[model samples]
Target: MTTRYIDAGVNLTSSQFDDARDDIVMRAKQAGVDNMLLIGTNTQDSMHCLQLARHYGFVCTSGIHPHDAKSTQADYIAQLKTLFLHPEVVAVGECGLDFNRNFSPRSEQISVLSQQLELAEQNNLPVYLHERDAFDAMRAQLEQVKVHGVLHCFTGDKHALDFYLHYGLMIGITGWVCDERRGAQLQQLVPLIPDDRLLIETDAPYLLPRTLKPKPKSRRNEPAFVEAIVREVARLRGQSCEHVAKISHANFQRLFITRRGTQ
Candidate 1:
C-alpha cells in the first residue's frame, strides 16, 4: 500500500508559487500528501494563507515572524485574534527568535513573541514556533506562558531538542535533515524524538531535501517532496516510512485539528 503523509508546514503564499499554486497542490495530492499546514509570517500574509487554506481545504497559521516582528502594527495581536476565529486558522505563529540572523532587534522579537504566546494561551490555540540561535531566550519566554505547538524547522542541538520534548511541544523536522553536511547533527538527533512528538514538514520553496533523486530543475521544494524528508527520517529512526507518516499525521491531528474540537 502507498504510504500516506501530511506536510506539517508549507509556505504556499510565497511569490514563487504565484502562477503555479494549483499545480503545486495537485502534485502534492498525487504524491500522497493529503493535507498541509500553510504558514503565515505576518498579518497580511496570514490572511492570504487563510484564503489559500479555504480554497484548498487546508489549515493555516496566523502571526508575525521574528524577522518581521519590528514591523508589526499596533493591533497585530488583535488581528491575529480575529484570524483565529476562523477554524482554518489553527495555530498562532511562525513567531519566535532568530538571534542567528538578528533580522529584528532581539528585544523587539522577544516582545512580539511574548504577546503572541499570550494570545495563543488566551485562545487555547497551539503555536507554530520558529527559533534559531536563540534557544535560551526562547526557553525563558516559553517558561512564562502555557502554550503548546510544534517547534517548526528545528535545527538546534541535543540540549535544545531535549528541552522542547520535555516541555511538551512537537518537533517539526524539515528537509534540513536531508543535508549531509549541515544536517549531520540533526541526522544524529532524529532518532531521539519520541514517536508522538515528531512531525515532518517541507518548509517548501526553502529547504529542499538534498536526497531527492533526479533533482527538480527548479530546485523548488513543495509539499510532494515531504516524502523524501520522511524517508530520511524513517531510515535514521529505524522505522518504516509508513510508521513515520502515520504517527506524524496523528501528531498533526492532535496538535492542530483534534484540539480545535472539529473534524
Candidate 2:
C-alpha cells in the first residue's frame, strides 16, 4: 500500500520548473506525494505561488524571505495581508533570519522578520519559518512573538532543535538528513522530533536527497523526491516509512489545512 504524503514546502515557481509544472506535479502524485505547499519568498512570488496552489489544488504561503528583505516596499505588510486573505495563502512566512549568507543586512533581516511576525499574529495565521546560523537572533524574536507553523528545511544542531520544539513549532525535515557529511548533526537530531511535531519537505530545485538512486541529470530537486526525504527520516528515527508519512501528513493538515476549515 502506498502512503499518501504532503510536501510541506516546495518552490514550484522557480524557473527550473518553467514549462514542466504539470509534469512535475503529476510525477509527485505518482511518487505518492499527493499534496505540496508551494513556498513564497517575496510578494511577487507569493502571489505566483498562490496562483499555482489554486490552479494545482495545493496550498501556499505569503511573505518575504529575509534574503529579500532589502527589496521590501513600504506597503509590504499591507500587501501580505491582502495575499493572506486568499484561501490558498495559508501561512505568513518563509520569513525569518539567515545570518549565514546575510544577503540582506542583519538589521534589515531582523526588522523585516519582526514585521512578518506581527502580521502573523494579527491575521491569526501560521508561519512558514526559516533560519540559518541565526538561531540566537531568531530565538530572540520568537521570544517576543507567538505563532504556529513549521520550521522549514531545518538543518540546525540539537540545541537549536530543542528550542524550536519547546517553542511549539513543527520541525520540517528535508534532504539534508540524507547527506552523509554536513547532515550529520541533523541526522542525530531527527529522532528527537516528536511524531506529532514532525513534517517533511523537499525544498525542491534544491537539496536533492543524496540517497536517491538514479539521480536526475539536472540535479534539481522536485516535489516527487520528497519520498526520499521521508524514507531517510524514517530510517534515522527508527520508524516505518508509512508511519512517518502518515504522521507527517497529519501534522501538515493540523498546521495548515484543518485550521482553515479544509484540506
Candidate 3:
C-alpha cells in the first residue's frame, strides 16, 4: 500500500490557495497524504490558516515570516499566542530572521525574532524557522531559544546542518532539491540528515519542483508536487520510494506529535 504522506509546509494565503480547502485535501488524500501543514506568513494569514485546517481536518502551523520581522510587535506576539491556544494551531513560527531580502530593518528583525522566540519558549511549542543569508545570526537567536523545531528549506553548509541537528532541530527540504542550480549542496546533504530528523515540503506556491505537474499561473504550488521532493530524497539516499515515504512520514509525525495536543 502507498504510505500516507504530509504536505509539511504550504503558504495557503495566496488567492490561488484561497478557497482551496476541499481541493487541497482531496489531492493529498489521493496521494495517500494523511495531513498537511498550512504555514502562515503573518497575523491575518495565521488566522486563515487555522480556519482552513479546522474546516478541512488538516493540521496547521503559523507565525510571521522572517521577511516581515520588522512588523513584529508586542501586541502581535500576544495575539499570536492567543491563536496558539487554538486546538489546530501547532508550532509558533515561520519566524526567525531573513537577511536575504532584508525587506525590514535588521535591528527590528533581531528584536522581533527574540520576542517571538520567547513566545515559542513560553508556549512550549516548536518553531518553524525560516532563514536566508543570515545563518550565523539565525543560529545565534536559535541557540538562545530552548524550544525545538525545523529549519525549513535549509540551504546551510555542513557546519550549520550539524549545528541544527545537534540542537535537536529537524531539516525541512523542499522542491529546491530538484533544482540543480540552487540545491546542489542539498543533494549532498540529504543523506547526511538522520531519518528521524528530516522532512519534506513543497513550500508551495513558491518553490515548485520543475518536475511536478502543470505549473500554476502565478508560480502557485500545490500539495501533490511534494512527491517529487520525496522522489529526490529516495534517489539521494539510495532507498526505495516506499521506504522514503514511510521513513519521512514517520519522522514528520514524531516531530509534530508533541504539538498534536494543540490541534
Clashing pairs in 3: 87-262, 87-263, 205-221
TM-score of 3: 0.93
**Candidate 3: stretches off by over 4 Å:** 19-21, 213-219
Residue-by-residue lDDT tens digits, candidate 3, 1-263: 66777878887666766667478667778988777788887888899899888877876777888777766655887779789778788787788788888898888888877887898887788888888888889878887868788889888888889988999998999998888887898889899998888888888778888766676665666777788888888999998878877777887777676556543
lDDT of each: 0.95, 0.92, 0.81
In the range 1-263, model 1's lDDT, one tens digit per residue, is: 87889999999999989989999999999999888999999999999999999999999999999999989999988898899889999999899999999999999999999999998888888999999999999999999998999999999999999999999999999999999999999999999999999999999989999999979998999999999999999999999999999999999989999998752
What is candidate 3's CA lDDT for residue 26? 79
Flag regions of model 1 displaced more than 4 Å: none
- Which residue pairs collide in model 1, if any? none
What's the lDDT for candidate 1? 0.95
lDDT winner among the candidates? 1
Give the TM-score of each candidate. Answer: 0.98, 0.98, 0.93
Error of 1 at 55 (Å): 0.2
- Model 1 earns a TM-score of 0.98
Candidate 3: 10-residue stretch with minimal lDDT: 254-263
